[model samples]
Target: MTAVQRPVPLSVLDLVPVSSGSTSAEALRNTVDLAAAAERAGYARYWLAEHHLNPGVAGSAPNIVIGAVAAATSTIRVGSAATLVGNVRALQIAEAFGTLTGLYGPRFDLGLGRSGAPAPGAPAPPALEPRDDEVVDGLLVPSPFAFRIAPGSRFALQGELLGRVPGDVERFDDELALIRDLFAGTYERDGQVVDGTPAAGADVELWIHGSTGGASARAAGALGLPYGANYHTSPGTVLDSVRAYREAFRPGVLDAPHVIVSADVVAADSAAAASELALGYDRWVHSIRSGVGAIPYPTPAWAREHPVDPAVAEAVADRVATRFVGDAGHVADRLAVLQRVTGADELLVTTITHDHAARVRSYELLAAEWGARAARPAAVEVA
Candidate 1:
């Protein structure tokens, strides 16, 4: 069979999930192995997300995981799907990403997001002063409902439930500016210039990730950086966020706007098989939404046997409804539509399942179908 020609490039966003009966060590190894498979399958990039205090997630430190994956895979771009910028100092991020780029060459990206993860018993970092002037002109005010399911809500709830005071989420824009300047070797403190050394001269792509069409989108547009909308996390605002990014875009590093949309998916040889693989998704989502950290990924049998409260079900309905689950062809068709609707330059897929082999197979099947579809011949010739 001919490979499907995709309308847009495809990439992977892995959480490095620790399965119901698996150890973190095993999860980490699985991540490296998956990266290698994804590279060989022709995926464009392999990114890991940052999640803290979550028993089910082992990607707490994305930079470190990125290094491991980059070393294991020869060509696929590797980096954080997003590093919570508000959690650490800008200089640290610069140095870390710089080192990765220096070692791996240009195959590294730095995708920054707004929230921070505070460790238990640690005081929250002080908030940077609000900059009214930082607001971009013509930016649309997002809907109130947008906040309800936005990624920030999850980050805030995670901190609250863990009894940890998180850093100022509002400081993201300022931090972004600092990081850019640091990377460019233009940062200055008082009368002295601050340098990021190896990182300051490293070549790395910068990206801004957001779930809402507010600050994050605007910031990316204003800076002319690539914007990634989190359709997987905030389905309701994905389009809005992408639109916002394009609207605020200015010609800078990129001559035009570029957007990457993320989606949660599960694919298999048969629809029934795919559905089985996605069975435990709702329970896992419920754990995160419930303000209790994510639990170990449950098996399909465990998810089916464990009763779910109607309220819990309702709360995670959006996420469950948004996830794409089907056989290869079905999922490939859906993703094509997603690419068209968002006009995304690329699509990032995040698939989680109990069995490591099944998870890898899902990506393999989807990649093949997507490639085939993209390369299909037109039915009729133009006159």
Candidate 2:
């Protein structure tokens, strides 16, 4: 097949999920292996996501995982999908990535994000009810999901253990500013004027990640940094979030708007095979949305035997509906639409499954297809 030049580069986002019956040590080893595979597959970057107090997730510390991943992969850029600023201090963020840069020679991105909703107890503003699966220009634009923290969630415990007061979501702008000040050698830690040193002189990219068209978008725009919108996790409002970032953008770190949109995808030799591998996705999503953090990734048989409650089903419906699952051709078509619609400079592909081999194959198949797909249609403006 003749290869077509893709408009956008593709990257991987690793959550380092612990599969059912797998040990954390095994998960960590699997992550390093995956990063190596991604590098060989021609992926532009490999990022680690931070998740705390989750029995199913082993990447509670992305910076450390990044170091391991960087050591294993030769050329792929490695960094945080985002390190939640709420639980970590600016001094820690600076020194961690700075040290990584010193060791790895400037191939890092310090992606920052907020774990909690920026506005606490804020009511959704009245707006037109969007239809489900509204396809704009070929891209599927899902109806907005109204997210709320589970009342019985154990997240507060995670907060307490991390030395943060429970439910204390801080200002995203303040956190952004603090990171900037640290790198500029202006912020003081422990009453001493701290020099940016390694961090200040490091050649690392600063990125802001967000799920909605709110605080994170504005901060990234105002700071002139690159922004990543979470379409894979927050499908319903991804377009709005990207639009928010573009609209709020100002020339500082970057002269023009630069965006990367993410998607959940699974690819196989056939659509049915892909669907079979993706069978347990809903259950996996239910765990996170229910505030239990992620559970060990379940097997297809286990998911088939134990179904989620109707309420749980409803809570994760949008995410389930939006996931791109099919053969390589089909999945690539969907991602191409996503990239064209969002005007993304790059696309971040996240794939998860119980079998490690299956997960790795998904990326390899998608990369092959993405490289051979036809030119994307013209960009469509969202009315």
Candidate 3:
């Protein structure tokens, strides 16, 4: 198999363990330890995902955790796997990340997602206003419409319309615009480059993460930000979404479009051992597909014995199970295939395992297999 010529930077999605037996402190410590190891292991980035009110996952506040992890490690890039921008105000996101950018320079990345961090006792996040039910009923709900509206009484709405902008839509746009301005303003206003940039105002690297095409891609393209597609759970749509993004891409914020696709990965010394590590993750993926509660990682035997429902099982199984589990050769081959299929400049890997040591080892084995390429060289010569 051809080697994945692009840099294979080992990275982590720190969900900080939230199992029944683990404590918050322990979770935090795990993040610290993981960050330190990732830095030492030559990983390029150590990111925390935003989730809320779920006992099975512990990354409720990505910013807070990012700060802690940043403090604990000297070199590895620290940032959010994503911040739930659809839930919080954009300025707040800017401020939090701006602070990190100030402290860490170009090493900080802000990945934005539309999903919200649900409150502990809250229900699932409010669907993006127009859901399938509303769509099927031909509901005209509201807008900031995608296209310009005419003054005529009739409308040709293909998708469900939500409603008119009752409040400040600029605030919404400003959320993003402001962040950019603030980043630039910090340097310009202060007359000093705090981060690495020689000019004023912060230019924190920005990325928009999405599971679909359309608004997210358009926004990222227009803003000149990098794009991260969520292929870890939505594997089927990866190619289509990426194609749409590249096709629709127009340079506004970025000189050229950059796309990263996330994937579920498992690796071990042998394919069987890697398969063993993947069983619990398979079950977890099964639960997500079935809309069941997020459960703790299960033993490989337990997962194999408890067959998931047949309806969503195939899709879940196909994406979640690793073809690369056996050993180094197997993982390298699978990754090469993934790189070819997605043209992913980078891969954000997510792994869920019951044993903490095994989880660390999984990436360690893969990094070892990727051999010297995975190892971080001397620091880049920053200006």
Candidate 3, superposed: residue stretches over 4 Å from native: 1-7, 104-106, 116-174, 186-200, 289-292, 304-315, 321-324, 373-383
Scanning candidate 3 in windows of ten residues, the lowest lDDT window is 153-162
Summarize candidate 2's per-residue lDDT along 1-383 as a digit string, tens digits: 33433558899999998999998889999999999999898899999999887889899988999999999987899989898887787767988888998998889999998765222333323343455668888777778776555444656556556666433354557767777887777778799976777777677799999987887898899889999999999887899899999999999999999999999999999999999899888888888767788899998889889877788787788899889999998988888888878889999999999999999999999987776543454454454
When summed lDDT is taken over every stretch of 10 residues in candidate 2, the lowest stretch is 117-126
What lDDT is obtained when candidate 1 is compared to the true structure?
0.82
- All-Cα superposition RMSD per candidate: 6.9, 4.4, 10.7
Model 2 misplaced stretches (Cα beyond 4 Å)? 1-6, 117-133, 165-170, 186-193, 374-383
The TM-scores, one per candidate, come to 0.86, 0.89, 0.74
Tell me the RMSD of model 3 versus the true structure: 10.7
Q: Give the TM-score of candidate 3.
A: 0.74
Which numbered prediction scores highest in lDDT against the true structure? 2
Q: Which stretches in model 1 have alpha-carbon errors above 4 Å?
A: 1-6, 116-167, 190-192, 378-383
Estimate, for each residue in 1-383, the C-alpha lDDT of model 3 and write its tens digit: 33325455556777775543565666667777778877776777888887554446677778888988888888887888677554566566777776776776667888876542222222332232222211112211121111222222112110112222223222444556656665675423366533423222555677877765656666776676788876665554555567777877887777787887776667777777877777656556544333343455567777778767676555454454433355766666666566656677777766666667777787777667665544545344333
The all-Cα superposition gives candidate 2 an RMSD in Å to the true structure of 4.4
